[model samples]
Target: MSSLKPILLVEDNPRDLELTLAALEKCQLANDVIVARDGEEALSLLTHRDPGSGEFTLVPAVVLLDLKLPKVDGLEVLERMKGDPETRHVPIVMLTASREESDLVRSYQHGVNAFVVKPVNFRDFFQAIRDLGVFWAILNEPPVTTRRPPASTYAKGV
Candidate 1:
């Protein structure tokens, strides 16, 4: 069987990204954390559209989405993910700097599995990421899909 797919991290801020990555690393969950600098890039990675190859199919274990992303923005990405049947079931946690009630309401409204407001303090940020990693990567049981049997099962005995 193929290895479990990586966890997608949709964040654009370099400093925040580094801190998040460090925190995840401390928890040892960073191994599968795939970083996307913006919402557009995040979408492309999730959709598996290789600009050169033209093939488009990717499904990750989870998506840690930042709300204030460039171009497409996080809410739009969340909307797209929830709207698409192929990608709808994947867990998405909204991570944002803003504590606006409107943003929180909209995030939950759009089907975000969790909403986390990133703290400006480094220690708090670290703790948040560690907790986030533990909850999503260790505690959560991701939705299951039926797997097909190997093609060899249909062949005659040697």
Candidate 2:
């Protein structure tokens, strides 16, 4: 059931990023991970044009977001994703260091599918990433979309 779709990691801290990537590497899911250094970059990579390419391509899969980010914050990214019709169905899991009650409440309210607080211990962090990878990549059922082919495919005479 592993779709091989890329996992989007939206994190700002270098240490956390390294740890999470390492944990993800240990997991059964060896799927390619796309990393965005900040919330703005994360949003662009996930929902908008690729900064280097400027193409409207669909990179299907879920987003693992961190709350505290530079530029556009995680909450803002979540809001934009949930607000848009095209991106709303994409599952967004919040993986952040913040344990504030308000952060949790706002995340869920903004339609985050899952919320995980960063574990202080290395073992716990690894376990959390592994579990997250297993569940989202294998267990979860994403929405299905049906669409007509592009105009180029249609007969010009008709």
Candidate 3:
């Protein structure tokens, strides 16, 4: 596992954040987890640029996003990310407590890779998080990006 790739967690609720962190820790996932308190912060982190080099920072392996958030909601965030070519490839999982069918439909429409309802029971929540961490961080294969040849190269046909 590449330690450079972090897991982006966008959750506003402190208790939920703590519980999620604990669950991930208990599962012993080696990847680092970066927390974003709200949707705005999550977007900032994902699109952050270095002042000196003007280069983007770490790209997360996966994003665990909550539905209800401050500044911007999860669905909006998902929409923005999916719309942008730079961030569109990053897998986003809707990890929320909402059971609304509309939210689920909208999430999938906005290109959310997965949607997981937060379990109320402690044991169930822990197990769910653990499974999610294992699958996304260790098992899932991200899409491969192929660079398009330059127009000149194609023009030459050599």
**Candidate whose lDDT is highest:** 3
Instruction: Indicate the worst ten consecutive residues by lDDT in candidate 3.
Output: 149-158
Candidate numbers, best TM-score first, in rank order: 3, 1, 2
lDDT of 1 at 75: 99
Sorting all predicted structures by lDDT, with the top scorer first, yields 3, 1, 2
Please give the range of 10 consecutive residues that has the lowest summed lDDT in model 1.
Answer: 149-158
Candidate 3 runs further than 4 Å off = 145-158
Clashing pairs in 3: none
Q: Which wins on lDDT, candidate 1 or candidate 3?
A: 3
Each model's TM-score? 0.84, 0.83, 0.87
Clashes of each: 0, 0, 0
Report the lDDT tens digits of candidate 1 across residue range 23-140.
Answer: 8889976336778889998887767644554544456667889999999999999999999876888899999999999999999999999999999888999999999888887788
lDDT at 128, model 3: 93
Using alpha carbons, what is the TM-score of model 3? 0.87
